[model samples]
Target: MNSARESLEAGYARARQDAARSLETKAGAVGAIATEGAGRDIGSTLLTMDSRLASLRRHSHDYADDLFRWHTVLQWLGWLALALIALKSFLYVLALELFHSDERMTLGFDDAQPIEGSYRTGAQLAIDRHFPHPLITRKQLSNADNHLVLAPWPGSSPLVRIIRRRYFFFARGSLLEDGGRVATVADTARGMVASAGGGQSIVEWTLREGEQVIFRYKDFFGASDNVSLRSELSLRLSTLLFGRVIFHSARCDSGEGRLLLKASVEAVDQAQLRAIPLERMIAWSRHAQFTVHSGRTPWKTLVNGFTLVRRDRGDGQHGLILVSSEDTGANTGSLRYLKRIFSSIF
Candidate 1:
């Protein structure tokens, strides 16, 4: 009986041990499954974050592209608006010309009467109308055709005087009025005749009585010949009077007349400037040319061309400024011009 009882207890103990091993094994397998599930969840979260970041980056690129497109559109619109203004000005001039022509025909107006006073007469009239002090007619020049007018500006030194003259009546000419003291700017062939002692300029432009063409020049110190930039500096056409423009600059040592004349002709042809109805190219401009740069670099230096300023003060009086070269001397004939134009225009 004792041996049977001991055998039963041993079998019960062995079964208990086996059951505990199986339970331990199942617990370890469940723990491993749970850990793997947690890892999968972490991986899924990372993938979602990466997708969101990529989407944000795409949105940023799209925004930048849209902004660039908008900027381009604005630039184009600005250019179009400028074009429309120019077109309007052109049409207005055309209509004015037609009206003037019709009136002239109906009234039987003489075409020559309007331009009766040549450039000289117009210039003299302009001076008398604008200048306060009376000009003393100087009889120093020998040329019968050439007339000299001398006037002293208010507050100006005795050394500096306003000297005006009509030159190159029939092309070939010579100025012998105090030879060394006078500064004369003749045709390109003549250039300028001046002595060490600088004096007032005598500008001899190729001007006709009633030719309505304005020639303006400017000089800039750069490699790029920015014609568009220069055009912005020109005088605005207030009426149907001014149109057809041309610009040219050769080397500092360029030959006179030929090159400039050629360039002007080419420009007129290219732009068809003849089609425009013009009245006169007012020749009340300075003729003297001064070298701004030092002697060393004189061969090639930038020159600001010319600024044409017309001051019409409601009365029949008119003031004109044709600055061929830049100088601001009160006596050199620039301050008077600036004063006249700025007083009216501004």
Candidate 2:
């Protein structure tokens, strides 16, 4: 009886052990399923975060492109504004020229009426007009019927005075009488002339009749220390009263004297004399100085020394004179004729 009871108890114990084993295996399978589900959830969350980050990067790139375009547009607009400003300034200058007119008429040379005395006086007048400080006094040496000689006064410099011993030869040629108008040509010659001393220069005029041409020879001599600095400047000032036009051409050295070569063509309508303002005429005259010095070296340096003024004339004609180096003491000439022709138009 005892043995059968023990075998039955043992079988019961074995059954309990087997049941425990089966339960452990089923628990393990369930645990594995739960782990897999958790892994899937985590993977799905990571994928969602990655997609959001990519969208943000795309948005940032789009914003950067937009900012770049905006910057480019602003830069272009800025350049356009500058160009417009320059254009307006140019138009203003053109407007001034179209309206203003005041004319000064210089009497042409006449042959018949006592031109001998006139020529002598005119020569003196030209010298006085050109040289504010005369280094020598001029004396009339000969006043014959057809020929005249002007004696040179003692110059300030002994060397120049000694050189001025030569006589100034003058001769009157045939005159052209065009109806009421008369133009006379005079020939002048001077030999053995020396430096004026200091920075002074002499411009001798030779007028020929048939060609209706005037030749001006400018002689300059440097200081004793700068004898090597010798130069001859020349220019032709031609005017045709019938055409109401004047032309000027000059050749000068490389230094401060370069202003001698500046020349330009300018015209104003004769009919619009009353409408142009004095200031406008003055500005035009001043601006025209640049036309002469547009190219070339050294003389261009004097561009800063220009001055413009409208002469107060009681007559109906308005006159403009652009003076370069207004302080006569400076080393420059009075560009009066230049301003006058440019201020008037036919």
Candidate 3:
């Protein structure tokens, strides 16, 4: 009987040892799984950091390129200014010797009035006549924000004068300097701030008689459209320097004259002026117009509503005209004409 009890006790002790071994094996497997999961998580985090760093590097490289270009332009402007001073001195001497000695002769004072008068008259006629030709009839939409009239290009050579005017407008707004560079602006204190995709955070404020506004496309450098961002950038910069701010952009729509275009006017301050580096102030002049078409054209005939007339006076003479007429409500004459034309066809 004692021998049988000893055998049973020995069997129970062996069973307990086996159970302890099984528990230890399970605990080790759980620990191994936990360690492997943590390692995978660390790897994922490192990859994300590397991607962000690459983007930041690209932005820095672009910023450096813009700064170099701006510096070069400033150097060129300095040389040009010296040349202009010398020319003015020679003209002054010529005027004194050729004309009367007692009377003061002005270089371009007499010529200014006739050009201004013609511009005003031409703009008024363009609006009243409603000519549909792209060259003659740029319809003045009722919802238009700003009206500008540029003086006719002077001198016999229109190409040279036009080039000068174009450069003058471009340099004035930093548009020439950094307009080609995307929406990203360099902030020394804060690394680089860019909008996701093509949207930006806008601040709204009321504008007075002479303020500047910027109009930016939603997808300026997208694969879908080939619209140039430079024209609008140059126009915005030119207007801001010489006129008031009025932001306008076309909205998407299916039918003809459905949404037309949206306008946003904002007041510019010193902070905004100081923020942009590429814009150089050459001289302030009025009569600036710029337009950018959104790629999505709903109707087959995309009739534009924004009107700021550009007249080419043969021999390289071109001018932009703006009319200060009555705001005659939102139901503009152009919209009425569209309804009349579309009603008969559709």
Query: Candidate 1 clashing pairs?
Result: 188-256, 203-287, 217-305, 217-306, 218-304, 218-305, 219-303, 219-304, 219-305
lDDT of 1 by residue, 250-281 (tens): 11111111001101111122112112112123
The stretch of ten residues in a row with the least summed lDDT in candidate 3 is 167-176
Off by over 4 Å in 1: 1-232, 238-346
- Which wins on lDDT, candidate 1 or candidate 3? 1
Can you write out model 2's per-residue Cα lDDT over 1-346, one digit (the tens) per residue?
9999999999999999999999999999999999999999999999999999999999999999999999999899979856744443333222222211212322122221111100111111122222211122132212211223243221323243234332233222112124464434432232112223233332231111111111111122111110111112212121121112222112122211111101111234423432321222211211111111112133433332222222333342332222111133332222222343333221
Superposed model 2: Cα runs more than 4 Å off:
1-12, 85-346
* Local lDDT at 171 for model 3: 8
For model 1 the local lDDT of residue 233 reads: 21
Off by over 4 Å in 3: 1-9, 78-346
lDDT of 2 at 93: 26
Local error of candidate 3 at 224, Å?
47
Clashes of 1: 9
Write down the lDDT of every candidate, Cα atoms only. 0.29, 0.30, 0.29
Instruction: Score candidate 2 by lDDT.
Output: 0.30
Clashes by residue pair, model 2: 100-276, 102-318, 262-292, 263-292, 268-345
